[model samples]
Target chain A: MILLAPWELLLLMFANFFSRATCMTVGPRSSMGFETCYCLSWRVAVEANNAQAWRTVPAQCVLYVENYMLGGQYNKDLDVVIEQISTYLNGIVAAGDGKDAWVLDIDDTCLSNLLYYQGKRFGGDPWDPSAFKSWAQRGLCPPIPAVLRLYSRLVQGGFKVFLLTGRDEEALGVSTAENLHAWGFVGYERLILRGPAYRGQSAVGFKSSMRKQLVEEGYRIRGNVGDQWSDLQGDFIGDRIFKIPNPMYFVP
Target chain B: MILLAPWELLLLMFANFFSRATCMTVGPRSSMGFETCYCLSWRVAVEANNAQAWRTVPAQCVLYVENYMLGGQYNKDLDVVIEQISTYLNGIVAAGDGKDAWVLDIDDTCLSNLLYYQGKRFGGDPWDPSAFKSWAQRGLCPPIPAVLRLYSRLVQGGFKVFLLTGRDEEALGVSTAENLHAWGFVGYERLILRGPAYRGQSAVGFKSSMRKQLVEEGYRIRGNVGDQWSDLQGDFIGDRIFKIPNPMYFVP
Candidate 1:
């Protein structure tokens, strides 16, 4: 690529900065695909140790995530993380106690609810509990390929994988389990759903607390892979915390 | 920070590229504390998701590793991976199967031997069999804190921690056992070092063969943690693999 002239580069930089500084697409086209500062300067930020540069994540990162998810970038990016995990697994010689746990989060982590998110246009709607519940009851969400492969390989490689999601246990338990099973997330140790008691709690607090319980119970969580940072947040998080991309919606 | 003009940004980029392109420090102090493209770009690379940018690793990354080893960065970096492991373990509800295994490598993985590496300035000297063998015989190599903690925790977590290294089992078996026990790596399942049969085999071939044997015997490799890539290499690897930094030497 030809180097940009000083003036031309400045113009491009200003345009990039302008777009991120505004919620320009928190409207009709938000989920259709939008660009962000991350998509602009990620290369420079990635190769440099400049912390300041990496902090350039777009304010409307969900838009970028939408595009990345629908575009080829998502698969390429996921492939890299998968390879890294495989490399990590290759070195592992499991404890074989059958207590080795690979904790997976449900939502965007295991099953990509792109359909819902796309329709919502990146949180364009609010508190439609009924509609969301109806979506879950469909029991038809597809499994994420990368996570599915990781889950299956890990089981063969010595881990007993489990799903620990924040879904309301009483309401979503049956469908969640059914959806997962039907979607090829066949054999897991358990599907731990949040109960009514967790109604108003924060994900971090809830997950951290629940994971603490797992530790106290004698389980050894070897790997926790999730899309949201919230999925990975909290106490007793596991041996490794791998955060998959999710700029769509902030749990907090 | 004020935004850089196009020219200024290009200048900085050029400088970084120049530093990495030359054998600038492949000299008297290459292993002392020289910087590499990694050190230069680690900050930005740390947080960004640009796989291509992050893939620009230095060819002589070992030199960069030397500084990181002596510097506080090594511990800090390792702490992250370790804490992640702890979190996983916390969520683990173990199977209590008598066959769970946590495979560990000797030499650089479990034992530090930093004194020699530092003296040699990160593989500065050529092969010194007598010196290395003598050092091993000293039975005084220190245990690495990060790995030591993982070992201890896995044991308490009901894992049958085992020593699987490239060291000669027949020659170093007694001393290896003695050294590990002496250094507080107590109560391992078994110390499987290379025997006469492994004399002419490569580390990858030998280790892979042994791990495969373990699998065929129905032993589950839950986790394998090591410093060298070779330690983590081969078939029948495990459930999860962790890599500790070691830029001093390349096993392959």
Candidate 2:
């Protein structure tokens, strides 16, 4: 009876159109498969934020801009996004065990490399090694919006927060911490950066090794969020690992 | 003729007694087992900045404290430690397959939380909700000694460095990054922290889940480092896990 209700039928029609509309929009810009993947991801991310259907699309779509396409143009509607991500994080934290819980990541995922991108003064191509090295040494980068809000909500909700990054270990003591304070981020219990590992592994290899170490230490990672696939690459089967958009670019 | 002559015997006896006397003084404290386990940790930590021995200790301790200790107190002795840990790390990075490596905890083991301690500013006990909240908000801390040097060495040496900590997700963006910068610590490829588990697991449980995540991603941790034993609780076997002193205090 409920399924046949006029209101229910109307709502179902709206959702179908909404999904199709999103697929149509993304399908042309990228490869067909990638487009399909993006559409599915967009839907998941949107639903992940808005508990309902696409009620929060406009809000979330702008967060991507706030993150990747910043400078000159700023969208005021982003407030909706900020609010939604915060709400999503709150739900995760609330879902946590009564004991401490947290999510972690580092690099462009949490600390924006906007400075790295912009520091080049928007010149010399996107991947400037020297500029990036200088940028990292300076330790100044804005917080990624969704990440900032998610972290804040988790902290505010009484869960412990951790920022695990791939920044060089020698530079972490100062650069990483100051960046966190400068950005007004709150509620992290510890900052885990790369240290030494067995000889010959790459940074990505080191990352997974570290995650495993955390398991040995006895802390559960409820929700893992990051821009790089490496950040989420772990055996943490039971937890929800949320990947935020890192459109500024990809890491190797 | 093969036996020692009278003069040679006398020389041997004199050398043995002299060695025994030296053993009575610094030898007991300098024994590999004791030094590695206890006494040398405290004494070496203090003298690390000035003593030549600082170079010989593992590099994990050096890079973890570069900004606060390596660059500050033992600035002059920094080079030796850098050289040593780099040599050690390079070997590991070169030799490691996906199956074996090490993970280091960033807080007291790699970086310093002295400010949190000396300021008497945790604001409240760890057990107190309000205090924990406040502490998470402040997010200002320094680096530990020896750690920075260790990190530098590991990075250069090719050891895969993964920083493991129990900090919550909320602090991922700002505090962690800033703190690392302040200390000038570097070379970590990943930072894993504690956060909420959707399946209702504790932070520790989530950490264990992460171990499988890391393995699937390709990389096995061969060793671990941290001030907290909890940082080393994951499932990878045969990896060495080293604990350093947390002079500021201990967590439950």
Model 1 chain A: worst 10 consecutive residues (lDDT sum): A45-54
- Say which candidate scores most in DockQ: 1
lDDT of candidate 2 over A13-58, digit per residue (tens): 4443332212232223323223332322332222122111121223
The lDDT for every candidate, in the order shown, is 0.64, 0.48
Model 1 TM-score relative to the real fold: 0.44
Per-residue lDDT of B1-252 in model 1, one digit per residue for the tens? 245666777755444333321223233323312343334233222232212112223445545546556644455445545654565567664476778887888887789888876766655455566777777877888888888888888888778887888887766777778889887998788788898988879888998998888888778988887766566656877876666644455564
Regions more than 4 Å wrong, model 1: A1-63, A123-128, B1-45, B48-252
Report the CAPRI category for model 2: incorrect
At residue A206, candidate 2 shows an lDDT of 70
Residue lDDT tens for model 2, B1-252: 134456654554444333221223223242322222222222222221111112122333222232223212222222223333344454455364534445776666676555553344321222344554465456665565567767665666555666666676664536776677667766567777765442345434555566657666777665555554344444552144444533223443
- Runs in model 2 with CA error above 4 Å? A1-68, A71-99, A119-126, A198-200, B1-252
> What TM-score does prediction 2 earn?
0.35
